[model samples]
Target: MPKIARINGPRAAFLRRFLPLLLDFDKGDKPTGQVTNEKRKEFYDCTTRALVLCFGYENTLGNDSPGDLWDTTYDEIPAANKMPKLPEPESIERDTVIKALTPVVHTWYKNRRTEANSPAGRAVLTQRQVERTVQAFAPLAPPPKALDVYQREFKQDYIDAFAALWAKKLEAAGTDEDALKVLKRQKGGKERAFAAMRWDQESDLKKKEVVQRCKDVYADVVKRHKSLWGSPHDALPNSRMWSAISFHRRSA
Candidate 1:
């Protein structure tokens, strides 16, 4: 008699327990070639549960709680003695899973259109339920919009440029009394304090000079930091700059 190889390991042990449950699609007696609404719901529910299990297993090996598995990719399971090789769970990218499952979903929809065109076929999934299904398996949110990305980069660049200019102006003047007074009144919000500096000045000429100097510094900083704000042509609008300055003044 030939001896059979025995599968042994934590992974094998886990699969032995859950794999059958994961594949257990049949609940009871069902009609042949007919995909009912109940069946569709059950299928998605089962898939979601199976994903949770896989996520749990990955989390357990990494000494992390299963609850902490949302939006995170699982690490590759190493091949152990007598265990089968497992692919990294992270291999399932958004496009990859959608590509693989979309065909099946389309086939089901086509079948519904041709064969099961009754009320059962017309049953639509709720938005909440669809959201839940997506949240269960999706590794990350959709990428940010182009405008949002540009705005974020611009905001950071503006902060760095403003900081450098403020430092330089302080060094050149040897005293930042007016700026410091505005800062104290504005409770140390740099943007607000800087804006307040113009209003706090008693002389109209001095105020005009302060505002012009601020505009000049901003223009120079933008020029110096052009690379950080995406393209060289991506300039901050004068209206937005003045509005930002006035907003701080009003807040102060």
Candidate 2:
């Protein structure tokens, strides 16, 4: 079956900025995992897979509980105040993947810190980095609507898969929400009607650092990958990398 394609605007934006580090190009060796020159297909598979693992395929797919099929929809997720729980790994959790990949993520941040510590990451980030970050997140922001509070059922398998990519990030900087706010210099709105909201502080220096980090990463990715920019369809607005940016107004 063709699984549904559900896009989280903010998360898609996050992945566009950072997940590129995961793309290892070899002139001689063929690319493994998700890699393609056809950007749309590449993004669809990569973004969907990443989301399915992080958010859980079962929650997004599979049969609904009892006769509750009519109630299952994307809007039902936010109200539940659901923090993701990862599932068990099918294979050994190799330290090498973490060891190899973290440096790239850390370096992306470190480069920004070096340039200005004001933001604390590179001048720009890769597409993968940005999208993956957003995709990896379980929604922390309060729902815009009142009925969005109901919780959706999820299986443990998705939780573990999502964790495989997130545990290191959390350990390095507390929670993902905290890290994003600290690193991005952003804040949630004060809506009394929303029960799941959490308060975050934004320091002058931290805000600068967060913006700088994101900016730097964006700049870096552009510098390294020229192919990502091509015909009209290849720019930021239309790319899968931008899918998570809820505020983006580009038509598909």
Candidate 3:
């Protein structure tokens, strides 16, 4: 019979801590006696499954031995010693589903916007026309529950993607800086042109004056574009002249 080698220090400590949980060993008693063939097989199977679950199949590198899963070449256990606990399988599945669906939702939004702004679409830009256009492309949208979860989880990623698209549209229309300001008003950033105008720095009277000025500008733009802005199908009315504004406003 092959003699079981004595394991000491960190490897012994690790087995003491984790083996019980992995094998459902009795916690009150320390494992003892010469290791039997049956016990060895149980340990190998349990450890192999644990390693595969924690680091994934790729980490195994085609090795069936659980001991081969860790790189002994390193003085330490690579970064695995500091790695966070594995998330529950259900959480992993939920995250995977959300990641897979986000791009599809984004693509659907882009295509719907494109079709709605087409010349033919613009010719019949009524509420009914817009509803019909959206309904025709309804299949493009992800299921509402999935979309809600994705939007909640990846809000910043969605915003950045849309902002990049909006920036490209502005560039294509040859909009200048002054025209871009109207649309920039709705966007959030620390580096905006009016960022220096903080409420705390201004007197109450000055703040009121500034607010009034913004309202006046917004009113003028709406008045000028009233005819074109009649339906959601229309792009931001005079968007070229208004410049850098996004057509889709996500609700807060």
Candidate 4:
């Protein structure tokens, strides 16, 4: 074996303890960067970008968890190991995630919609379930009228969408089953664990459905936004109604 290249310092320490364990390699002979084959390497890139986008790795990596991942880091170079910088509002996959979520969010707040023009900044959602979904995405939600605001909201959604896209990608890539297993393991929790278990036992068709429906993204719903989302202007596009899949401008 050609000796594996290594990186040390804070980034090295970070690779060891992050959420998805697959991305958690840097000590062993094959550091997380050089994980055997190209597929896992692809997993590394996808997961890291998603992490930076979702957690704001730029701000969060060393503290409690991911806050905001930056374009650069001091202790350890984040872009090392072939990782790519996360794109912003213009990111197609990220935009797809937010757009897909917008319709559902509107439906959840329809009562509010009918009541008054609630400022997009307020908690807005009353129900616990909806509130939890919105809140659990903390350090990542605020009035998304500006690019900075739009950025915070997109982080978590961007991560989910990346996972959804990667699952399909891995399945299509052939028998590198290990990568899929690692991806599944990262979703640890009673609910997600149960879902992962069921996925393991289900038919291929069912698995596909779980991945698609669960991600809350539907190509059918988002196809409408292709024209607006394709380029990147518009600040989430549309004025009143949800003319797109993710977010439409509201009273700000």
TM-score of each: 0.17, 0.22, 0.18, 0.20
**Which lDDT tens digits does candidate 1 get at residues 65-158?**
2221132221212112211212334223422443343344334333434432345633322322333333333343443333222222223324
C-alpha lDDT of residue 39 in model 4: 38
Clashes of 1: 0
| Candidate 2 accuracy as TM-score | 0.22
Model 3 alpha-carbon miss at residue 201, Å = 51
Q: Root-mean-square deviation of each candidate, in angstroms?
A: 25.6, 19.3, 30.4, 22.9
Best by TM-score: 2
As a TM-score, model 3 comes out at 0.18
Summarize candidate 3's per-residue lDDT along 1-252 as a digit string, tens digits.
112223334333222333323223322254343444345344444433333332333322222333322322111222322322322553354344333333433343334335445776454245434443343333332222322222222233244445555566567647577657644544333222122323345466755555565455445545543434344356533333222133334322
Model 2 lDDT per residue over 1-252, tens place: 214333334433333342443332322154432443343233333333333333333333332222222222222222212323323342222222222333333444334324432343344434334543443342332222211221113223233433444545446777667675553322111121121221123345644554555455445534434433334345544333344343354543
TM-score leaderboard ranking:
2, 4, 3, 1
- 2 against 3, candidate with superior TM-score: 2
Runs in model 2 deviating more than 4 A are: 1-49, 53-58, 62-200, 224-252
